[model samples]
Target: MLNVSNVSRVFGKKAAVDRISFTVDKPGFVGIIGRSGAGKSTFLRMMNRLTDATSGQIFVDGTDILALKGAAKRAWQGQCAMIFQQFNLVPRMDVASNVMHGVLNRRSTLATMFNLWSEADITRALSILDRLGIAEQAPKRAEALSGGQQQRVAIARALMQDPKIILADEPIASLDPMNAQIVMDALHRIHTEDGRMVIANLHTLDTARRYCDRVIGMRDGRIVFDGTPDLLTTSAARDIYGADASFSEAATSTSIDTLPRDQNYATTLLGA
Candidate 1:
């Protein structure tokens, strides 16, 4: 389980993340929603310990995350995989090589720097690539693939880490609608089939409603709404995004209803 207790991050007069507290005990897909500068990304970064929290504590499965140091901290970071928005892959390296780097956090300095990956690691990388539906791309350069494919490769890299939790920061903000659905589907599959907890910082309400079992809305660095997608009503959305709720809903609907199975639900909740 993951426990966040009144965590906050302050920068001068601005609090990027306020005294927020939440917990995740089940394996499922979670979406963090908010407008830009709403601290969604900051919150995820804090959870991953990519940056430090200003105050309060974060614990994962009885371990004091904020208090951990050195090799222990590195190990924790490796286990909590992060998939970045920019598809952080080596442009020149082949896909398998890039995926192998995911294990570097747990590998020795000499072996990592020398790139002496064991056969087991190579096998693991191939399996992850195949599972993500990109086995053929393993031999290609990461830069050679399209944005959606690159993102899949990034997901593969995360899976290679064998993480219990996957944190995706704006994973699909740059993609077009079709690609966005594919990426979201892959994330959902990871949560359901592999039982890895998936948490994403999402930009659109419709996408969040479609893929996340739970939705969290943040504004000015604080959570304004927290509930299941079924309970995220129109009033709740307006409260979350204020006057821009309708506009956001319009954009989100035009973008996420590729198949329209939830068109009615989304339209009703979107208050369109």
Candidate 2:
């Protein structure tokens, strides 16, 4: 279980994520929805310590996640995988190679530097791709696949890590509705088939209604609503997103400055 107690992430004087508390004890599909700049991504990033929080307590099971250090911190990240809006694959690399990168943390220091993918790791990567229905593209360049296919490749990479929790930050935001549905299907299948908790930041209410077992609404960095999909009334959505807001309109920021642009960041983001 992931327990968040009075969590807030402040950037200077602005609280990107205000004081919020929630507990996710069940392993299932959860959708987080809100308008643009509602702090959804910030809260998700804070879960993996990708971004720091000004003050808060975060625990997985009984361990204080915020207190971890060194290898322990890396272990915490491995337990929680994250997917991004953009399919962050190495465009120039083969799909199989990109997927194999998921197990970088599991490799030895020398092995990682040499990019030594063991035979078992290669087989596992292929198996994951086959499960996701993309085995045929294994030898192709990641950039050659369609958007939907690329996202599935990303999911396969995440699966390779064997994470306990999967956090998808606006994963389908950049895809068309048809492609988005495919990505969402892959996400749903991952949760149901593996029993890993999936927390996805979603923009569309209809998608949330169709897939999420639970809906958590964020507004101004606070959790305004948390309930089953059926219980998320139209009025509640209005309160969460404000009146006259469309599904595509979300308060998001383009801030990669805080995230390190390195191999470490790439691997950490995958398993967190």
Candidate 3:
């Protein structure tokens, strides 16, 4: 279980995340939606311990992870893997090696520097890439793959960590509609099939509604709504996006319905 109690992050006098409390006692897909500067990224960063929280505690299975230091903190980070909008793989490295890098914290620096990965780790990385439908690309340089394929490589890297929870910060913000659907499907599959908890920072309401079991709406450093996706009505969206009375839902819609009617394109978006 993950419990965040009154967590806040202050940059000088401004709070990026302010006194927000939340709990996730079950394994499911959660989508955090808000405007560009709505603290969604900061909240996830705090959860991953990438940034220090100015106040309150974050507990995982009863231990206050926020208070952990050194090795203990590193252990916590290992269990909570993070993915980014910009597929943060080493572009110059081969895809398989980049996936193997997931276990760097568990190995000696000398071993990693010398590219001395164990056969078992190599097999595991290959298996993860295959599971994501990208094993054939493993021997290729990461920079050679398309953006969507690169993102899958990033996901494969995260899976190699064997993390209990995956935090994806804008996982598909840079992809086309078909690729976005493909990436979202992978995340949904991870939560449903592997039973690992997934918390994604999403931009489009349509994406969240389609993939997430629960939706959290944030605005100005605070959560304004938390409920099942079905409950995220237009009124709630207006509040989340800070739209006035005349605001059209189109402001936050990214539904593939707007895509071109090309046969191949439609088939791709439909996961054909």
Quote each prediction's TM-score. 0.92, 0.88, 0.94
Instruction: Return whichever of 2 and 3 wins on lDDT.
Output: 3
Clashing pairs in 3: none
Find the candidate with the highest lDDT and give its number: 3
Tens digits of lDDT, candidate 1, 64-108: 788878988888888899998999999999999998888887788
Q: For candidate 2, what is the TM-score?
A: 0.88
Please identify which of the two predictions, 2 or 3, would achieve the higher TM-score against the true structure.
Answer: 3
State each model's CA lDDT, in order.
0.84, 0.82, 0.87
TM-score ranking from best to worst? Answer: 3, 1, 2
Candidate 1: lDDT of 146?
82
lDDT of 2 by residue, 224-249 (tens): 99999898666777778877444323
Count backbone overlaps in model 1: 0
Q: Quote the positional error of residue 171 for candidate 1 in Å.
A: 0.5
Query: Over 4 Å off in model 3, which ranges?
Result: 245-248, 257-272
Query: Candidate 1's C-alpha lDDT?
Result: 0.84
User: Arrange candidates by lDDT, highest first: which order?
Assistant: 3, 1, 2
Regions more than 4 Å wrong, model 2: 244-272
